[model samples]
Target: MKKVIIAGGTGFIGTYFEKRFNDIGYDVKIISRHPHNIQWDDKKAIVEALEGSELLINLAGKSVNCRYNEKNMKEIMSSRIKTTNILGKCILDCNNPPKVWMNSSTATIYRHAEDRPMTEENGEIGTGFSVDVATNWEKEFFSFNLPKTRKLALRTAIVLGKNGGVIIPYRNLTRFGLGGIQGNGKQKFSWIHIEDLFQIVLFLNNRNDLEGVFNCSSPNPVSNAELMKLLREEMNVKIGLPAPKWMLEIGAAVIRTETELVLKSRWVLPEKLEKEGFIFTYNTLDKTLRNIL
Candidate 1:
């Protein structure tokens, strides 16, 4: 069986990718600070896990749900950049490095937009704390010394699945009949189903031609209002509170993440993936919602 090493394979998306690759007959090797039961030093872990593997997928990161204070921000950046740097070093040291490296990236790197969709090559660079986070993350990811390993930086959108992410809260709110729009509900939110995300990662892992930044999001992104409407309608929720701007600001302060990020208008689109002829099984909001709900 073909082998692949997955850093941060114990988390939500990583777990899904692990299962998908395993189901397809790939010998999946997982690596992390403490991955399930397996243990290895950073340098040794990466090289050993990737010894005969075809690819290395990096998904290590601190969760962004909490406050992004000075210390937490430092931890977030270091967790991703330092781990990536160490992994890159391992690859550079190895005589036979993995053929492909799909480093995790975020779609929030692009400037928020209310109207136009963001293509990989055409989107505006973001500003503020989140942008700084993405910049450092990318800087470290591209600093590896290896030349044999083909790489792709995936600027991914929020993954919506029954098991995780922004949708879970929405699901709870809808179930309790407390669902409503937040902060005017006009900001655009880009999303991809968890299955589609895993499939794209696997596709990129096997496809030698796919490289550089690929915006991994659905072509049809909906505004926050539309997303709320769909969720409430599907969950049979009626009569909910509309969260005002001040509440979201207070939430931002309380949660430690940037208020602007939560309210950022990002109309992201996956131009490169479509151009490269990658098919997304869950593209439409209706289809995706039905599958999960």
Candidate 2:
């Protein structure tokens, strides 16, 4: 059986990938903080896992869903950089490293692009804390030189799925009646279906010629207003109370999270993926919400 190593394979995205790979007959070994898996600090074990593996996907990182306080900020950055460094070093130590290594990156690395869609070929790198985290994460991932292992950075956007992801919170909002437009409702919401994301991984792995950065997002990104409207429609919700900027700020504070997750205009496009003949199963917001809801 083909072997695959998924570092930090405990979260929603990682869990989904683990199950998918297992179903397809790959021997999926996990490297995580969990007792059953190879611990992050175990360099020898990690090297052993990566040796002769077909693929290496590092999804280990502190989630950026919480308040970006000083401590959380530090953790968010360190978790990504440290884990990536470990994986890179381990791969280097291996006699036969994984054929391909796809590390997690964020489309938020691009600026708040309201005017045009940010693609891999032509996207402006943004500023601020989240952007810094994304930039540094990619920098660390690319810092290592492993000639035997092909490296690809997955610049993923907001992932939507029924089981666990942004969908749960959005569903709750719609159920309650707060499913209206958020923060003037003009921000571009770029997202991808979890299944499509998984497919992209396989797609990249199959085509060894593809390397470097690929924006993992849907081609047709919708505005915030359109997103809320479509979501409400799908959920059969008739009444939704819009949350203004001030209200969102208050709510974010109460929830101990940041508003950038909702307010930032992430207009990212999968130019390279599409150009390479990759097709998204869930192409539009309507189709995505319909499948998930």
Candidate 3:
């Protein structure tokens, strides 16, 4: 059986990957802060896990769902960089390192663009704390010199799935009639179904020719209004209360998350994936929502 080692494999995405890999007959080893298979601090254990593993995916990062205060911001940046740096070192030390290493990156690295979509080949990188975090994370990931291993930075957008993830909370908001167009509702919301995300990972792993940054988002990015409208329809809600910018700021403060999450216009396009002939299972927002719901 092919062995796969995942850092920070206890989160929603990691857990989903674990199940999928197991179903496909791969041995999944998780390296997390808390011991599931191996602890993050255990250098020997991590090295041992990475040795001879077919694939190594690092999804270990502090969740960006909190207020981007001074402390949280530092942690968010450090967590991603530190984990990725450590994993790179472990892979370097390994006698038989994984052939492919998929590191987590965010589509938020791109600037807020009301016109045109950002792609891997021509995307404009943004500024501010979020962008810095993503930029620094990728810098750390690509800094390693591994001629034998193919490294892929998954510049993922918001991933929607069942039970958990960005979906359930938004679904609940829709159910509660709080799901409304955020801010001016013109921001481009880029997202992908969890299934498609898994497929993309598998696709990258299978194809050795593919490398570097790949935008892991649905090609069909919808406006905020369109996204909320679809969610309202899918949830069978007749009315949704709209939230203005000021209200969003207050709500974000109360919830301990950043309003930039909803307000940013992340119009990302998967040109590389499409050009590579990767077909998404759920391309449209309606279909994706239906599958998740």
Over the stretch 244-273, how does candidate 2's per-residue lDDT look in tens digits?
Answer: 999999999999899999999999999999
Winner on TM-score between 1 and 2 is 2
* Shift of residue 70 alpha carbon in model 3, Å: 1.0
Root-mean-square deviation (CA) per prediction: 1.7, 0.6, 0.8
Candidate 3 TM-score to native: 0.99
True-vs-predicted CA distance for residue 162, candidate 2, Å: 1.3
On the 0 to 100 scale, the lDDT of residue 1 in model 2 is 87
The TM-scores, one per candidate, come to: 0.95, 0.99, 0.99
lDDT of each: 0.82, 0.95, 0.93
- Residue-wise lDDT of candidate 3 within 1-293, one digit each (tens)? 89999899999999999999999999999998774469878899889988889999999999999998899999999999999999999988999999999999999999998999999999999999999999999999999999989999999999999968988778888999988999999999999998899999999999999899999999899999999999999889999999999999999999889899999999999999999999999999999999889
Tens digits of lDDT, candidate 1, 1-293: 78888888788888888888889899998876674634536566667777667988989888777777788888888888877887888888787888998898899898878868889778888787777888788888888757799988889998888776777777886777657888889999889999999888877876887778889898889887888888877877776677778988886786565566548887899998898888999998988998899
The candidate that wins on TM-score is 2
Q: Candidate 2, 102: how far from true, in Å?
A: 0.4
Q: Candidate 2 at 160: error in angstroms?
A: 0.6
lDDT of model 2, residue 5: 96
RMSD of 2: 0.6
